[model samples]
Target: MSTSDDDYYSDGIDIRDLPKVSLHDHLDGGLRPQTIIELGEQIGLDLPATEAEDLADWFVDSCSAGNLPDYLKTFDLSIAVMQSEQGLRRVAREFVEDLVDDGVVYGEIRWAPEQHLQGGLSLDQTVVAVQAGIDEAIDDAVRDGRDIRIGQLVTAMRHADRGLEIAELAVRHRDRGVVGFDIAGAEAGFPPSRQRAAFDYLASEYFPVTVHAGEADGLDSIRGALFDGRALRLGHGVRIAEDITIERSDDENVYVSLGRLAQWVKDREIVLELSPSSNLQTGAIERWGDEMDDHPFDLLYQLGFRVTVNVDNRTMSATTLTRELGLLGDAFGYDLRDLESFQLNAAASAFLPLEEREELSERISAGFEAADNEGA
Candidate 1:
């Protein structure tokens, strides 16, 4: 689709030029298909698709299967390449490069170290490799005159019993490169309550957290995310829309009531890291509809939720943060101010210290203000 004012979009600014902050991105989910193929070849792992372009197409097709397990199957190939220290470093480096290309000034890349241990790397070693890559990329970006900051969100598989371990790992690396902790996997059966030990430990240490909740499940899962996980943010918590009861509507406005869970998430300003393309592909918003237009993003924004846009998985969803914002602007007729609001939401929700978050917010506001003046 033309991102310019041609047929597809006329958001009054180059979406690519507008600075963005990505809070729910996944490290494994953002690998280039060609990189996967090359790394797999190095390790003698044959791929389902031989050609890089074909492999890219395969991933989009695979993730569109609309269930977490099916979506997760696409990761086998990417994770296969990411088994070694070299592989992890290369992918992490490229991840930041891609984010910079997408105009992201800040991003939190989440991935599971527990899964990468199949290749014999200890969790600490894998983190070291990933951090080396992040620092290398940061230096490269500085050389290129683009400043970006990225931190890791260490994740534990919900089906496993290593939440407490992963939580400790996250805290251990807090000053090194780690920013937060998360639980990712089957949500329906594996509730956050099951990881109470991890959550309690993280809470005691005052570690920030964001859980994948209310996407595959409903209100109870969301509650667990907040109370058990003590989530400072939510990963694709689109299904929280379920708690919003629309009682009546007129031509001008719609009347709705927010359930307590929904109310708390909204009032607390808990960031909703909503990925439009990924949510549709993963069926996270199937209760609403199968298409982007059917998404509750507009409703949530209208109802005062802290909805921040993200490209959860760049390769899997065949999207960039710019493309995601462009599609949303096209769909909702949002102007630069609206887009800035999303960025501000992400900046405010970052795992950074309060002073740094305020600085980021100021920088963002300055950029948008400059853009506004140019338009004027």
Candidate 2:
């Protein structure tokens, strides 16, 4: 099921044509390489590569460092070129356009606006500029007969102390395309408790939240995301696998046990934003193994945890939602039903209202059914 020439197919079906929902896509990490080269030049920033293909290759090679901190270093270049309003708008617009190219019907584009404010734009202005790009892209998509919807998930850096301010910023723009709040960056030392005030404020405002946990850190971080941050979903919560213990294995069955934390997450159906390629790149799944087959995604799915596949960084991982699904299919022998379940999980977990979420689920079902019929 490996992708060829940036396209993916599985079981006689074009994976790229299947309607998908992307919940954990990072806007800063999904920029076009040519755009980065152009914007970097405009800002007098020295890029490692001038050509788009070489720059794209550089990102993949640089981010494949097998550790989170090392992998994150590649973002400095992408974020640097995104300081101005024009840069942000272009990146955001193309971000949605690329989602449509990947057959994503709905996506939540998450990025830290504070990082993009250095080019003389205020926090609100940054959101507005990005939203402007998104709006333009959505309009273009509609005119081209492609239907897509996007939402902004405003993010605060975990190592920074602007949590409350970012939370307020997100709430202020809730009616202007922003749909949720999140905290990302180094997840080890800075737990969600560090942003308690922000979480408290967001909760008071009834804003949706998703915390980056269980990727660079472990269960305590996830507990903080759940209990302290009141996160509606977990970003790359793949490390929750640590809480499960394999008791033993027999000929036909493998006995296992789940800790209270894992049990609670499963019982409550907390969505795990599992990014197959990024998890491997960031060493989030190193505990299991270094390969996609080692990913706990199949295990989590088998255990009935609400799991959704994602492309955490399209540029860094050189992946799309289609490619991630194809890799999972290669690793776990997933069928069309398995893939549809992942989309359905993401649709339900989207920060959209319940009615909109239901409508999204209907779209996914219809799209997959059409693909199924074509294959049959």
Candidate 3:
């Protein structure tokens, strides 16, 4: 998504200049259009739009329509270019580069390997190619004096039957750049309970998972994500807002109550990876209102829930973690401390090991401290 104008226009400190953690970014959803054209030509896949600008605008317009099916169809084009090893590597590398340029300190890139096997590559081969690109980009960013870290959240499609295999893939590659596992795609009909085998396998392997829940469905889907999938974090679990009730009250105070599910999520510190733009575009928060102010991110945070901002799809949502944070700041009057809290939440919710997560938190705190000290 766009990060150029994400400066702290109202917050007094430029949000883009702060270090951020991206927990819910998607690899397939963040492809560069020019790269798509180049890669598409090799595979003989005809693009809907030949020019990069048209393609970019097309993505923006398609996603802006606020329909989940239409939003997902854009991936058909991105996935078309990512079927081969070379295409996967190029896309992954650019994805990392784009994150570095956007000032992301850490990110977890999630995508299903099954979608890339149309080119005769095995699932393992796809992981290898994507990891190679991530490594190359990491080394390049280090050479450029930019410190950034990324981990793969190897994902399986919820409607697909590859959950167990993909969970095994993620665990197998855990030490080799894969950090976690996830299930995505059509959350309405496919609940996490359907992937019981995968979650069981992942739990047995001590693997981390973050399931896409509460986006296309409601509380039952979220319950399935937590109870069945054992998700360490909720992918756009913004719909947990539905579980909260606002009771009428007099001038003294407004009575608010949380359903059992919402209470459990809040008490357990389950991180809600809320993507404001994507939430609006996909109608995740349409029940609240049509604007960013309608988002329950503020409510969740106000209620002491572990809510972290995210850019669900960099291309489709056209957002960065910084932009998401900036928008939240604009909507809720949040400052640097609030932004830092979201980063801390993401750092904690990361699929990385505890030690690595602690280090990430330290880095984030230090970065924010330096920014504040310098500004002062």
Candidate 4:
């Protein structure tokens, strides 16, 4: 194993050199520490730590509070600086650059535009600002000999009552840069059913939707996401493991029984955006255990569920998509084949058109093939 500043290696192969697709990454959760400092300074918002490194550490520490609500507290600082169009554009631009360093060929960055209205920017303006940043970063990365493609997943806060409005905002910008709709924040008390109007509207328009479910709640929430929201994908559906029953056979083989909910998800091939480290930190997998090895990711993958690795919050987890893959490899004894399969799963699950998704799969296959040949 080898570790560098921006890459991790197993068997002398740098994981960062492999093509990756990021589906569950959040814009507010992946900020650079220095960007937060400069933006916070301009806005006169007091931050937990002034130094970049310290602030980074603070995010990690604060997020390690063992619950979803506490983990979400770290976002307040990031969102504070992102109210202005300039701030939003800069952060979104740097976000793409960071993804480039992590070797992400395609990514979907999700953020709630309603939160950024404090700077007097309308919902459409916020989307435009973020799209501007994403475009600039793509051009810059291409100029520098890196290829990346990104789309926005316009998110609505589930705890709030503006789901229909946010859904409209996302649909309105679908042609501009938005690719999908999502409902994030406080998944316990507020279910996707609360956003039925939005989901209904989105369904009428045939817009893709992914809901944040099974992280703070359990199987019922997953049910709500599927039935009410008609989610094409699940954000951190780690807790869907709750619906499965496991038993050991006499031959020591594990026999698994899936409840109807889990069966539906598996049969339909619903994508589970499984963030291993973030799930552990937020106690999303506490029912299983308190460590990485205890995560249900391996079980889900072994059972042939559509499990894709993610860094749900990069700064809070102090990680990148590459690092997340390395950690999963470490915990689950995965090799290049397993890692490649995860990327292919993500590529297939991306909210792009069928043609675009096929192109992404081709890119991933070629990239992994080249990496394997180089290592050999």
Task: State which candidate has the highest lDDT.
Answer: 2
Model 3 lDDT per residue over 273-327, tens place: 8899999999888899989988988889989999988899988876777778878
Candidate 2 Cα RMSD (Å): 0.9
lDDT of 1 by residue, 1-376 (tens): 3445323333455667777899999999999988988888888998888898999899999899888779988888888889889999999999999999888899999999998987899999999999999999999999999999999999999999899999999999999999999999888999999999999999999999999998788889999999888899988899889999999999999999999889989999888989999989988888888988889999999999999999989999989988888788767778888889999999999999999999999988988787677756
Residue 339's C-alpha lDDT in candidate 1? Answer: 88
Ranking by lDDT: 2, 4, 1, 3
Model 4 TM-score, 2 decimals: 0.98
Q: How does each model score on TM-score?
A: 0.97, 0.99, 0.96, 0.98
For model 1, the run of ten residues with the poorest summed lDDT:
1-10
Relative to the true structure, candidate 1 reaches a TM of 0.97
Top candidate when judged by TM-score against the true structure: 2
Give me the runs in candidate 3 sitting further than 4 Å from their true place. Answer: 1-10, 249-254
- Pairs in steric clash, model 4: none
lDDT of each: 0.89, 0.95, 0.89, 0.94
Model 3, position 157, has a per-residue lDDT of: 94
Angstrom error of the Cα, residue 216, model 2: value is 0.5
